[model samples]
Every structure is written in C-alpha cells, then in structure tokens.
Target chain A: MALNTQPNLFEPGKRYFRAFSPGDDFYEALIETHRDLSDEQSEMVNARLILLLANHIGDIAVLREAMSIARAGVVAKD
Target chain B: MLSTYQYPKFEYVRPPEIAEGRDGHYPVVIVGAGPVGLCTAIDLARQGRQVLLLDNDDTVSIGSRGVCYAKRTLEVLDRLGCGEEMVQKGVSWNVGRTFFREDEVFNFNLCPEPDHHRPGMINLQQYYLEDYLVQRARKLPNLEMRFRNNVIAVTPGEKQASLRVETPDGAYTLTTDWLVVADGARSPIRTMLGLDIEGKVFMDRFLIADVVMKADFPTERWFWFDPPFHPNQSVLLHRQADNVFRIDFQLGWQADPEQEKKPENVIPRIQAMIGDDREFELEWVSVYTFQCRRMNRFNHGRVLFVGDSAHQVSPFGARGANSGIQDADNLVWKLALVMDGKAPATLLDTYGDERGFAADENIMNSTRSTDFITPKSRTSRTFRNAVLGLAEHHPFARALVNSGRLSVPSFLVDSRLNTADDAVFAGNMVPGAPMDDAPIESVGGEPWLLQVLGDRFQLLHYVADAADLDAASVAALQSLAEGPIPVEPIVVAARGRAPAGLRTLIDAKGRIRERYDLQPGTTYLARPDQHVAARWRALDPARVRAAVARATCNA
Candidate 1:
C-alpha cells in the first residue's frame, strides 16, 4: 500500500552493460513509447500514460511519493 | 442544388419612405430577416408594436443551416404561431446513438418521459424555419418586411437609434425608438459600434454535406468518433426533412478546406461511409470553422443585439440558432414592458443578465464538445480515445464521452428577475426554469397546458376543491389581473367543475399537479416568456405583488 522507496524493480538472472539494467530498460521502453510523437504529443502521451499507470497502481501513497519525488526540485509557477 | 426542394425568392417592393422621398421613424426596427430577427419582429408586432424588418437579401437562408431545433425553441415558435408548420415539415427525433470506431458505445433518449407536446429535437432546414417565420410575420399587420433594405450604419442615441438604410431606389435615413440587431454572427452593426466578441476560436474545420438520398436510416442522431472511414476524426449523421441527410465530417486544422469541399473529394468520403452502390446527389457542401464567443453585454443603450449578432457557438450542439430564438423570446417581453412604460428601462438590463448568463453556459458547453471532437493536444486525444474505448462496455465511461451535449434551454437560476423560492418544492419547475408542458383538459377539449397559458405574466394557481378558492385568493387574482403589468390568472383543478368566474383548466390525470409539484393551494408566477418568476406553497397577495415587482425589476 505504501511506496517502496528502496530498490523495488528487479529481474532474476539479468545482466546489462551497466548497472540498473531494469531502470535502463524502463527508460528505453518509455523512449520507444514516444518514438514518432512530436514534443507536444510526447508530453500528452506522458501525461495520459502516467494516468493509466497510476490507475493500474491504484495506491494513493505510492502515487503521492512518486509525484513528490518527481516534483522535488522543479519550481512551479504561481 | 437540392432536387427535392427549391428556394423561394421573395419579391422586394420599394418602400413608402423611398417612394415618397421622405424619412420615417418607427417603434421597433429589426436588422436582418434571419430566424431571430423575424421571430423578434413577430413577437413585438403581435404585442401591438409597429416593427420594420430590414434585410439585405430577399430569400431564406442559402442552405440547410441549423437543422436541429430544440423543444424550447419550438415552444417559442409556437407562441409566434409558427410551431405547427415547422413540426409538420421537420423531422422529429429524440434518440441519439454514439459510436466508437466500429462498436456502438451508447445510445440515449432525450425525452424519456412521455406526454410532452414537442419532441426533444427536430431537424428542419434553416430556410424552411426562416420561411415559416416570414409567413407568420406577414400575418401580423404591424410588422413590415422590407426585403432589400439593408442597414449600412447604426447610430445609437439617448432617445432613439438612427439607421442609414440602402434600398433599390436610394439610400435613406430612418430612426426607431428601439433597434434590435439580429444581423447574425458577422454583424455589421456590431462592427460599426466597434464592439468585439470575446471567447475562443477553435482550430478545427468541419465539412457539412447535405446529401439527398432515399435511405432508411432511423430518425436519430448518429455520431461516430474516429471511425474507420474517417480514420481519426468525428462524423455526425442527422436526418433532415425532404430526404436530406446532414453529414458533418470533422476535418482537422491541417486539412485543406477548399480541397475538401470539392465534389470529387467529398463524393469519395460519402461513398466510403454509405457504400458505393447507393445513388445519392450532393445537395450542398460547405466547410466551416466555429468559435464560441459573445459580446460583453447584449444590450447597448437603445440598441439591443439578439441571436448570432450577440453570441455564437460551435455547431456541434445546435446552440447557435436555438439560443438566438430564446434570446428573442427573452428580450421581446422585456422590451414591450419598457416601451409601454410599465417597467423601467432597467428591466431591459435583465435581458443581458439572463441571456448573457445563457450565452456563457452555451459557450462553455460548445467549447467542451468541440474540444472532445477535435483534441488540440495528444494527451487529450489519448484520454478521449480511452474514454471511447471504455465507453463500449462501461456505463460510467459512457458519461465521459462527449460528442455534443445537445442544446437545452438555459435555467436562469441566478437571474435578478427570479424571486427566490420561499417555500419547499419537489420538482424541476423551480424559479427561473422553463415551465414543463403537460396534457390538460379544458372546457372545449383536451389541450396542452402551455397552449392555454396565455402570452403574458401568468398566475397559475392550483385548487383541489372549491373551498381552496377563497375570497382572499380571488381578490389577489383580481388585483394581479388589473395591475399596471397585468398577470392573467389560470386555475388548475385536480377534480372539479369549473369555478364560478375563474378561468379553470381540468387537470384530469393530475399530471399538471405532479409536474408542478402542486399542493392544494400551490401558486406560481410565470414571466411572459413562460419562465417561472416565483412560486409559493400558499398564495399571499402582498408576497405575490412583491415577487411580481421583483420580477419586473420594479423592486
């Protein structure tokens, strides 16, 4: 129910050219999700994809933690 | 272009002012002979005001524009004596089906309840609507229709509004006590006054093809989102009268409007949707980009703006013409009172207050429908697709699918003219809401409730028994009937013989009582346009007088 702030994503018996291959795979898939999209479209896809994933996650605590962490250093306009 | 229908050209005769080489003044001068202007002229003239209607053109609308007429608009037209003709000539429809890709997402019945006189909506060509209105206007002796007289300039003044009009003979100057500007969206009068409409112009285009074909499609509105034929756009299919079907294909901002309008490009699109074998002729084809905008104030001193001249909305909801008709309905009564000096000129301000509020509501709904149909950003489209995808099975998601909200009369709940309810009510017939129509039995025969409710301020008092019609109640009714701004009192009885002297309508089935949420002594004060001004559980003479005063802006 709560966010796993610690190391969470894992795959048994997996190796990569560098560490955090799971994170790299996620990054690569995210990039591929926005492959042919323009910047505006990619932003739209990111927003909707987040909503879809958030609905799937279905955890307020995890969403709050993820959102806070994502927004940690970004200054929002008034 | 339509084979089934031919446009009738009205003969323009030289006006008396031009023939006699003299200027003239009138009580009410309406610019533009469109549906709104014609309706306004008819409404004012029927109330014994002299009205001169000027139009640049001599015929009805060019094409099948504004095909859907809502129930509220039909009711307004009924008051102008044009409702029956329009309903008979138009295609009545209430059901709407929405499709997502190839699958049917949801269908809705606009008027699920029975016994209402008019349907949820009717699809009639704009030309027919204007023609019917013109015919009705002609029957009114006080209304003068000057077909070729075009208003070139308007000068609004303290006492009157002056207009420079051009006709076949020559240009002439005329003045009117009140000027009604119903000249449409591209109002030259609005431009001459240096006024501007403030709102959002959607970056989208739609091609309207009125295809004449003998097809057996049900009389229902069918809307498709991202269908296979269109492959990423929306399409709306509606049945108009005379074998004409209005097909609107949503073309995105990047689409070439001029290229898409060509018959060669349009024919294939229609064929792709309806199939190749069906024989059909393209009646009319036009591309349009819409905006949801309105003037800051509809009333500018002596000059009043009505219909498209005051506000405009996207065509998706059919709000543009319907709301304009309502605007005329709302303005005429107020203007009559102000002109007769029964109500202060300030009463006219509520026209702006109420209809301005309505304009915003319409603009908001229209803008939302436009956004859903044409998503500006990719994420919005993603959500739109998600909603459409989920809507096929899930009921909640169907609610999220917004093809078009469809035009409904705006409830002027916050209008200053509406007296706040002092008693508990259990129905939708609240103050500032349009009175719901119900079937009732009169002395002559059975007629709809609204048919008997005369075109004036009305006191609808409910009486369950003869004892309820007390001396105090009769006195109150008599006083209101004889007031400065007279209110006609109509008695609605649950079960009874006609009252001795009162005008009584028999609520045989108690539908009127149920719809109005009437107890034995329930009373309602309705405005001239049939909007509820106030209601009370029990009739109080002083309170009714105060409410009437407030409704007329005298308080």
Candidate 2:
C-alpha cells in the first residue's frame, strides 16, 4: 500500500474504459448502420470513424496504417 | 470467392491455405487465432470438443498488440496451459511515473508481484503472447489451427452460427454451435452484424515508437508535461524490458503524420527531451488514434465479441488489452458451462452485464486520464499546471500524480457474486465477509472462491458451524452450501485459537474490527462467486432456513 493521495485523472490507479457509451456514436451506429447512405458517404464516414477511434487511442500513424491496411485489403482481395 | 475483409489489427483471408482437409469439417470455427480467440478454442476443446482456428494471414503477427496481461487473464491462460509461457516470456511492470514538468516521481507499483502470483502488468508484445497461446492451442488434441483462411460473413441464428470462409482451393462455409469474435477493433463480424458502437472521439494523436536503447532509462515509466522536452507538448515513456522503450508524444491532433515520419521528426523530439540523450535506435513507429466505444451488446444471438471488437478504450494505463483479456476470462467459463449444458444460456447474460459495467467504467477512466493529461481547455491547463507546481514543492501535493484512479475495476456484479455480509457488500469485495476463493482439486493452481453455497446461494462466514449451528441455521447453511452448485468452503478462524488448516481472520481482540466488524458466536454467509449475502447471530434454524429457501426461489 502506498500513501493516500488526492484522486487525479492522470494519477496511478485502477480505472475503467468503454469505447461506446449512451449517446455515443455506437448508439449512432445503431441508427447509422441501420440506415442507407451512398458508398462515398459511407466510405468517408467509415474512414472518419476509424480515424476518430485511432486518434483517441493516442496513435494517428497506426490508424493511418490501419486505413492503408484496409485499403490494401481491398486491393489484395481483388 | 469469399469477401475479404480488413481489420485495424490484421487482414482476414478465407479458406486459409495452410489447413485444408478433403472432408475438413469443424464443429467450432474460430476466426483470427489471436489470444482471445485461441483461448476460446482451448476452453471449448477442453471439454472434448474438436475446434478449428483460422488465421487470415499466413502466420502469427510479429508485432506488439496487447502487451499488458492482467492477473485474471493469466489465470484463464493458465487454465489453457500457456500461463507459464506468458509469465516467463513477458516482463512484469508494476511501477508508474507521472511527470509534471522537470519534477518526476514514481507512484506505487501499478500492479504488484505478490509473494505468490504475478505482478500488475506484463509488457510483452501482442504477437509473443499470441505465439505462446497458439502453441498451447496446437497441443490440445481437439484443436486445429488454420492459416490464410478469411471469414467473410458471420450469420447467427437461434440454434447456430455460420461463417463463410474463402480457403485456398475455394470458399467454404463453417457452421458452429457458437461464435466468439475476438477480432480487433475493425471487426468485420461486428460490422456485418450491424451492432451499435457508441463513444466520443478525442482529437489528440500520438506516435508509438518501439526502440532498443543500450542504456538504462529507469525500468520506471516517465510522463512528460512540457513534452517533447523542447518542442513543447506532452510525452509519456515506458520501459518494458532491457533495451526496450515504448514512447508516446501527443501530436496536437493535426500534425502531418507523414512529415513526422521523416527522420527529421524523431531527432527534434528526442533532442528536446533527452538532448542527444544517449544512443537509441527506433525499431517501429506507428501512429494511432483511440476511441472509447463498446458494442451495445457483447452477444447478438450466438456471435459474441471480445477484445477490441467488443469494445475499445484509450490506451492509458494499458487498459485496452488488459481489460479485453479479462473480458475473455469472464466470458469463456460461463460460455463453457452453457455450451456444455451445465448451466442455462441466461448465464451468458452475466458476461455482458459484468463486463459492460467494466467497459462503461473504463471509458470514464480513460476519458478522465486523457482530460487531465491534455490541456484541452485553458482552465484544465491552469489546473494541471497548478498541481504540477504544487507537486514540485509539496511531496504530498504530488497526490494528484499518485492517484490510482485509472485502474478500472470490473468488480463482479453485486448480487450473489459478492459474499461478504456487511450490508456494505451489497457491492464489491471486502475481507472477512464470508467470501471464498477456490483451489482446483485436480488443476495445478489455486482457484479461490468466496461463497455461502447451496440452494439459498448464500454467503456465510461470520456465522456458526453446522454442528453448533442452531437447527434452522444448520439447515440454512446446508441448503446454501449443498444445493444448486457446491459452495467450496474456505475456513477463516478467529485469530488466537484458529484450527490447523484454517487461516487467521478476525482476532478475539478485534484485530479486524475496523473492516469485518467481528463479534463472538456469530456467523456470516456470502453469496456464490463470493460476496456477503447475509450475516446472522444465534441460529434461529427455521428463520435461517426460511431465508435460504427464499434466496434460492428468487435466484
């Protein structure tokens, strides 16, 4: 046990993580994934969604790589 | 031809070329033989069920994915025989550092290596952990590993789930009684199913650089506020093993990733912070953005999501992989029992409720961690700087840096899972409250459980024994301890005159008075899965039995 300290967001301790919560885009996905959009819109939305998430995790390059990975995926499959 | 899908972590290919049998039919087909998926296979195969695990790529990933292994995940892997391998291969990290300007300090160990078990976190690459798991999956008589096979679609129905795999020769369909989607965040299965994922996006971006430096940088972690040392941003550094350093520097949300890729971006950041500080060569540099979102439901009929596919959290505190693995540990056993008909399908619902709570809490935690570290608002910057300023002169002021708030806990669902009866335990774990930890009889290790078992599903500890237990009370313990499932006993006697095998618990002199609130001639009952269910004094056998009977009826 260590000395008690005031609670801090950056402080060392156990905390929880949730990617999607109420009113989050995950909730939006329930509405979005259910609706129709153009391939371009969906693609941009998808790209934004991926980038949005990638950025949140603290790495944009990997996310860009993830995009490249996804794009390469289309080519590889072809 | 099967539809080929791409995920953030790996590419999915179908009809994996590696394993194709003329009549290759698998009862259970697991896609992406990552740690969680493989562990799921091991759990199913353990019950004499043959399983086929498919990987889209030719081999296991040779990179880092989830480097942090939690205690629960270790226990689950231990059950699958890879526990030792993981423990041996990974470096255990317990201490964490928080930097407020030049004033640096190490907080308490994030996770500890107790005298008996492993420590807080294991900083091993994702691929290494998966390799050990894949090897263990191979040894199982009923397990098969298929590579280069991509699963195109996941269709789940009331009775079964099917996967369309595009193999080398041709596309084939695999039908399994159940499906566990351990695919990474960009989960095709999740997309195909159209499950709702919700969360906010932080505008910050950082680079994850894996480097091998010859010199020591304090096996301790370092957090930088006036980051990049010179460029002026936030930086976080972690040392996992000898010569291995994981550094993260916030990229201000709009920095050109390509520009940073120029070896030019590297020196400035390093020089500013370390000032040509020592020799270190970068092995891998990847840019990433994090999202905190979770599938509204972990299970949509037979298809279930674990790991990033189920949810995602910002990488603060190494919570992403650690929690994902815990999701696996929590889901597998309950799924196993349901699959084996040992329990009903409702048992699976516990998986979502328990882990979902963990997920929600994690999102909140990582979000706070992010907010505190970044100067998103002027007020936040001032508040952060004030704390940093205080921390420099007042060691106690550094409490802001030492707070352990990010250790998101998925404490079991309150009801019967908790067995301590302090009324306070209508919530989480507290010692001396009729809880139980199980030690597997045939298995090599101890599996602790805190429980007051039987039909009542009670948690009894601060109560009397059966012999001296008042008649009605004896009937209650029996009903709780023997009925629906066995409540394994873990005896904790009063300190001074405890029995030989029993551990010393509450002392007659009231050593545990602050916590357990001990008293003489009283017994307590905890629920199954270990949390206090009820406490009693002087067994009124009929009343006790009646209470036991009532709980069973409700459960």
Please report, in order, the local distance difference test score of every candidate based on alpha carbons: 0.85, 0.57
TM-score of predicted model 2? 0.70
The TM-score values for the models, in the order shown, are 0.89, 0.70
Accuracy of chain B in candidate 1 (TM-score): 0.98
Compose the digit string of candidate 1's lDDT tens values, residues B179-203. 9999999999999999988887888
lDDT of 2 by residue, B1-555 (tens): 111111233334434333454333455567767777777777677657777777777655554445566655665565566777787767766676776556664355654323324455567767677767766776788887767677888778798887787766677777787778887888887888888888878887877776666665666666777743634567877665445667777887887777775556865676566557587767667677788888888876677788788888888756777677667666665666566665677767767777787788677667666766765654345445655655654444455542224343454534343333433322123422322223212112332221112212333344322223344433444444454343433333333322322222322232222234544445555433233444554334344444443323323
Query: Pick by TM-score: which candidate is best?
Result: 1
Q: Which stretches of candidate 2 lie over 4 Å from their true place?
A: A1-78, B1-28, B47-49, B111-116, B228-231, B275-277, B394-397, B402-408, B413-484, B490-554
Candidate 1 lDDT for residue B10: 89
Give model 2's DockQ, 2 decimals: 0.05
Please report how far candidate 2 places residue B23 from its true position, in Å: 8.3
